[model samples]
Target: MEFHHLGVATADASGLAALFAELFDAPVAHEEEFDGMTVLFLELEPGYFELLEPHEGGAISRYLENHGPGIHHVALQTDDIEGALETARGAGVELIDDEPRPGAWGHEVAFLHPKSTGGVLVEFVSH
Candidate 1:
């Protein structure tokens, strides 16, 4: 499982992006809008850093308001998302999305909630 991306929940998207730019000397690679989320993807050596801010009012915004900026989830790249999700389910992980869904950047992804992974959200994606 290759490290794909780290999802960061931030109240201020531009502020966090600026900080990353200053620290890593890397600019935002791309920006994508999906459903109710606005995601900023930043390239980091072998993987990526994703800054997620709620577009209007949604789960991410609520999470940020309640918990401040923090790591939201870790995404792993896989060849088969369905196989991974099935494996997770077999192991009794609490999946947020029981089925894989279309994700950002034309990938299929599924999320296992934090409750099932020691309070760490895990996402498996098939490119």
Candidate 2:
């Protein structure tokens, strides 16, 4: 598996992404709107950071409402997401999405329940 990206839930993605852009002096690799959210992918040396701002109501917005802006999840790249999910299930880890779903950068993604991942939301992805 490879480190993919850190997805951060924030109220102001444009502002926060801009801050990160200045801090790293790196260009935003991609920006898109989907499922009531605006997302920015800021590329780093090895991976990227995904800034999520829910324009309407979605997971990120709900996260902000409940936890108030924080690291939402860490995405790890895998060769096969479904295989990875099955591996996790075999290990007795609960899953938020039992099946892979469409994700940022056109990858297949699944979330392992935070309860099973040391209280950090862990996402498995395969592009």
Candidate 3:
């Protein structure tokens, strides 16, 4: 697997994207809105950082309310998402989704629960 990106929950994605631009000298790589959230993707040396700003209500909103703006999850890329999910299950890791689903940039993804991962959410993706 390869590093994909780190997901960050924020109150203002665009504003944070701007800050990241100045900090990294990198422009936004991608932008999208879904599931009551706005996402801004920024390129980094290895992968990217995704800033998630919540709208009315959703996971991001709840995350912010409970933990404030901060890192949400880390995503790793694989060649086979199904195989990765099975490996996680075999290892007795709790999963948010038992099966892979479509994720950003049309990649297949599955999330591992934070409870079993040192309180850090982890996602595996395959293009």
* Clash statistics: count for each candidate: 0, 0, 0
What lDDT is reached at residue 32 by model 3? Answer: 88
Tens digits of per-residue lDDT, candidate 1, 1-127, equal 9999998988677788899999997589888887687788888987788899787887788888888889988999999888888899899988999888998878799999889899888889886
Q: Evaluate all candidate structures by whole-model CA lDDT and list the values in order.
A: 0.86, 0.88, 0.87
What TM-score quantifies how close candidate 1 is to the native fold? 0.91
Candidate 3 local lDDT, 1-127, one digit each (tens) = 7999999999988988999899997689888876677878899987889899888887778989999998999999888888888888899999999998877667788999999889989999885
Candidate 1 local lDDT, residue 79:
92
Candidate RMSDs in order? 1.3, 1.0, 1.1
Candidate 2 lDDT score at position 122: 95
| Local accuracy of candidate 2 as per-residue lDDT tens digits, 11-84 | 88889888988998756989998678888998898888999988887778788989999899999999888899
Instruction: Specify the poorest-scoring 10-residue window by lDDT in model 3.
Output: 32-41
Deviating ranges (above 4 Å) for candidate 3: none
Error in Å for residue 49 of model 2 = 0.5
Tell me the lDDT of candidate 1.
0.86
